[model samples]
Target chain A: MTRKILRNVGVPILSFVLLLLVWQWVVVGFHVASYIAPRPRQAFLAVTQNWSALWPLILGTIRETVYGFFVGAALGLGLGVIMAKVPVLQRIVYPVLVLSQAVPIIALAAPLVLILGFSVTPKVVIVAWIVFFPVTVNVLDGLTHVDKDLLNLARVYGASRWRTFIHIEIPATATPLFSGLKIGATYAVTGAIIGELAASDGASLALYQEHANANLNTAAVYGTTMVMTAIGITWFLLVVGVEVFATPWQRRTVARRWRRR
Target chain B: MTLLELRDVAKTFGDTIALSPTSLAIAEGSFVAIVGPSGCGKSTMFNVIAGLLTPDGGDVLVKGERVNGTTGHVGYMLQKDLLVPWRTVEDNITMAKRLTGRVSAADREEARAVARQYGLGDFLRHYPTALSGGMRQRVAFMRTLVTHQTLLLLDEPFGALDAQTRLEMQQWLLQVWRDTGRTVLFITHDVDESIFLSDRVIVMSPRPGRVVADFANPLPRPRTVDTLIEPAFIDLKTKVMRLLHREDA
Candidate 1:
């Protein structure tokens, strides 16, 4: 058990520390100005010293990300089910979904903020817009690709259409749904950050980063970025945790494969 | 009593004639096996009987009722266990019941009892991924049995197992068949298996499949590994093989 933990947790920490060391060495060895590039130690110091001021902005961005993620996930799942069930709708809306992704989120966010005014609504919309595409596409793929033999078995057993969808189709789609959610989780933070950068009268981590950049406080800028990165990682880990809980069979399958090898 | 009767059933997929006017009847509480070459419409016939495919002509009568393009008359099993990977062994076993309607406490009890009887009690809550191929097939069989259908159409249920596991599963299946006494229409390519497990062995002709020969096995009840070498079993197997070879010719 301890060995498993060491492999799981220790290895990533070790690699991350190595990266930090490399970053610090490059900053010091190059004799880079603090205004241009701060060392790892300076970035950490900046975050720790200014944590009191940065906390609310971090919380605000996190709130935006969380709210947007749930809204996007719900919408994506609903649309995906609708599209999967109705082939005509899928043919009509699928291309539109792809096009929505192709349009730059920055451009979309600016217009959204202008229209919605300076509130969390625009940020949530931006985040949802960014998060929905992966979720929808993955869900559609998952539903469409359910094993035909299982469907046949369901039919032979006289499963109603609703029963088949709930018992067979939904469970079959869980893995792919989680796949989209994980991808969306990583994008969610970026969406919130972009939304804040576009226009935020309220205090936000992105605004803090902009202020730090304008003052040439590169260490503070890096610190804000690190917090954003942390939030992104947290969101990703959260999705993974839920996936692990929801799909215990997947882990068993992987473990069985490992045992065979 | 006749449990299932297929009268001149035909299925054609565009230019390809999958099954050409096939007729057969299965008696209640009897085990029957159909042997045919690959692409000889064994699956099409099974699908037709299972109501997955509407026959181009004739009727499928289950217990004297025509059930065309309608399902739930028979429990069907395929070569692939097709157990839902996410569901537990007990869940997989009771899947047919769950799918058909609300599973009662008695239904769950029956599933538990069946699992325990079949030596899957300890793994009731275990997922299919954790089970072996043979075990998965057993779970699939249990799933079919719990559907409460008097007739079962098993399409090469043990075809994917290794030789040793296949033999074990055959014996296990025979025991289950004897215990349950459900009418079984088993499809396989193995002549020896057909003679061993079935009361009657059916041999189908090549593509656009039709039954060319149906032989009643004279082998006694409680057949075992020793039965494989018995004169009656060998004789029946040889006759089935010759008939199959003639079709190939």
Candidate 2:
């Protein structure tokens, strides 16, 4: 099992290096002008050289993303648990939650920016909007979709509702909750970027983005995008690592599912 | 003394009645097993007895007092070892005592002593996910024990185990039951299990269910799994099997 996990970690990293190697080759081979798409190495170099200069913008975006992620996740998970337990809440608010996720948050960005002004508020709101539905829906499904026999067993022990939540409901729903958090983390980065793009008139990166687009500083754009993707991937992998550590119960289930693949 | 009585207990899902006004009494200290073919009301009876559902017609009594919903006297274990994956075996067992009442240091020591006596002494700190299937079941059993409830309702507790594990568990359970001396009402479709464990076995008919047969196990006390091959065990098994075939007929 340790070998399997080590193999999984090593193989993916090597494969990613191979992929980038090919990417660098293809970009250089086709004489793809820097104006069109920057070389992978150049983009890396640009990001590295500008790393210190980029800190304030990166930190600013991370702050927006994190604030949004927490607010959204807490609300979503809380409402999800409520809806799962209470039919009236399910009837009233579930459809609204469904609708809330339907309208692409990208479509909502400009107006959100206008209303919330060119401030951190719009960005945080956008991130929260992006992170909410998946956490709520997945968690609610996990909490309510418990096995019938297990429910009966709890009842027989005369487990209090609170006790059942701690012992059965929450634990049973762990896989889905972890999945929700992982997905929420990925969207958090995008949500923050969207907030920046939409409300960037006075922001540090905003000024750079306006000038960069005209000069076709595509390397810079790709650098920002690559950095954001790295952040998102880091967030996702952190969640995945936590899931593996906390829910050893899922290791077998995940292995079995992976085996079928 | 009658500890629990079900009077006219009937549960229906839409037009289909699962339990039909079934009435039964469980005496204190009696280990009774309810047995029947699949789709019978054995599980329904256990649920009613456990107070998980509201019977359309009847009332459930715990210790001769009418109880409408889930109560504390009954400790239930099910087919699956529902130990929380994140909890240590000791944590799982200790959960039943957490919020109840203040205990002397001696009582906590006694709880640990009991767990150690039950073959789980070494595994207190280990998480449920670390244990094997059988060990997990033992932890589940120990958890039920921590509550110190008088009545135990086991719903096919060993049904999910392999046949070998299943037989071993039946014998192990007998020892535990004899040790604890809790009133046990176990539900299963396994005729042999019903015969092997209980002083009396109640057999029920299939859906739209009713108890069609009840047999008393005349086996000797301190029974071993080896006794299952004895003539008296064969005779008891034959009787339950006959009632089971009657359900098919």
Candidate 3:
């Protein structure tokens, strides 16, 4: 277990430290001005010194992301299941859903801010919207294409539609659904930041980023970037944790062997 | 008494006929094997009997009542084991009872006992991925039999196994059939398997399949591997093969 942890947790930390060293050298050696590009230490100091101002913005972005992720994932799964079960609904709505993806999220953000009037609602909606398509597509694919022989066996045994859905459809769709969730998890944070950038009543991380960039406070920009990366990593890990527990049967033996070593 | 009777049952998919007025009856506690070449609608016949397909012409009467276009009458095992990979062997075996609200304490006990008898006691907690193809089929058979359905439609359940596993499973199946006394309608292309496991062998002709011949086995009970070398077994095997191969000619 210790060996496994060293490989997993230790290696990443080592690589990250090496990257910071390189970054520090590159900034110092090139004699880059602080206003254009800051050293790692400067960025760290910017985060620590400006903690009070950055904290609330960070907290706000996290909230919007979490709320948007749940709502979007729920809606995506529900609609995807509906589409899989009823082909007519899929036929009517599928083209429209595809078309919506073509119109960029940025284009919608301005109109959404105008309509919703600079509330958290717009931020949450934007996050949810960005994550929806992948989740829906994955879930629909999983449900429709379950193993044919297994389905026939269920039919012959007189399994009720509900039972078949529960036993066969749900489990079969889990891996694909989790794939969608992972993709959505990454997008949720970006969506919230975009909404905040478009229009916000007060300070959010995106607004902080805009101010830092406008003032050429390069360290503060990097600090905001670091905070967003943290949020994205945490969200992704949370989804992965759920996937690990939800589908124990799908665990890889190769991974288990590595853990054992 | 006849447990299952098909009366002039026919089926067509669009302009193509799948089964052509096929009729047969299965007696209670009897083992029957149906042998035919591929595309002879052998599967379609089993599907109709299992109530997976509606016959275009006549009736499928189970215990003298017509059942058409409905399922769940017989325990059906397909070519693949079809055990849900996510479920353990025990869960897969007892799934039917759970689905139908028959999962009483007694039924659970019966399922455990059956699993034990089938040599799956040690692996009850293991998922299907942990098992061999033969072992998976054993679980599938147990799953089918544990439903306590007296009629079984096994659509080439052993067709996927290796030669050695298939032979062992054939003997295991015979023992189970002897013990349970369930009426089995088995489908196979192998003439040897048909004659070895069946009391009666039914043959079907080419596409839009129809029953071409039906003959009772003259072989004795408690059959062994030695039976394969016996002249009587060879005679029966040859007869069924001739009937099947003639359709090709």
Best by DockQ: 1
Q: Write the per-residue lDDT of candidate 2 for residues A41-117, one digit (tens) a residue.
A: 88787778888888787788778878998888898799889999898989999989889888887789888977888
Task: Give, for candidate 2 chain A, the lowest lDDT window spanning 10 residues.
Answer: A252-261
Worst 10 residues of 1 chain A by lDDT: A252-261
List candidate 2 segments past 4 Å from native.
Answer: A1-9, A244-261, B12-14, B98-112
Per-candidate TM vs. native?
0.96, 0.88, 0.95
* Candidate 1 lDDT tens digits, A208-228: 999999998999999889999
lDDT of 3 by residue, B1-249 (tens): 999999999998887788899788899999999998887889999988888788889999999988887888899997788887677777788878766655677776777899998888887777788888999999999999988889999999999999899999999999999999999999998888998999999988776678889999988988899988899998988888888787778
| DockQ pick, better of 2 and 3 | 3
In candidate 3, list every pair of residues with a backbone clash: none
Model 3 residue A174 CA deviation in Å: 0.4
> What TM-score did chain B of candidate 2 earn?
0.93
Worst 10 residues of 3 chain B by lDDT: B98-107
Query: How would you encode candidate 2's per-residue C-alpha lDDT over B115-146 as one tens digit per residue?
Result: 79978787766667778788888888887876
| Whole-model Cα lDDT of every candidate shown, in order | 0.90, 0.79, 0.88
Candidate 1 clashing pairs, residues 3+ apart or interchain: none
> What class would a CAPRI assessor give candidate 3's docking?
acceptable
User: Which portions of model 1 miss their true places by more than 4 Å?
Assistant: A253-261
User: How many residue pairs clash (N, CA or C atoms closer than 3 angstroms) in each of the candidate models, in the order given?
Assistant: 0, 0, 0
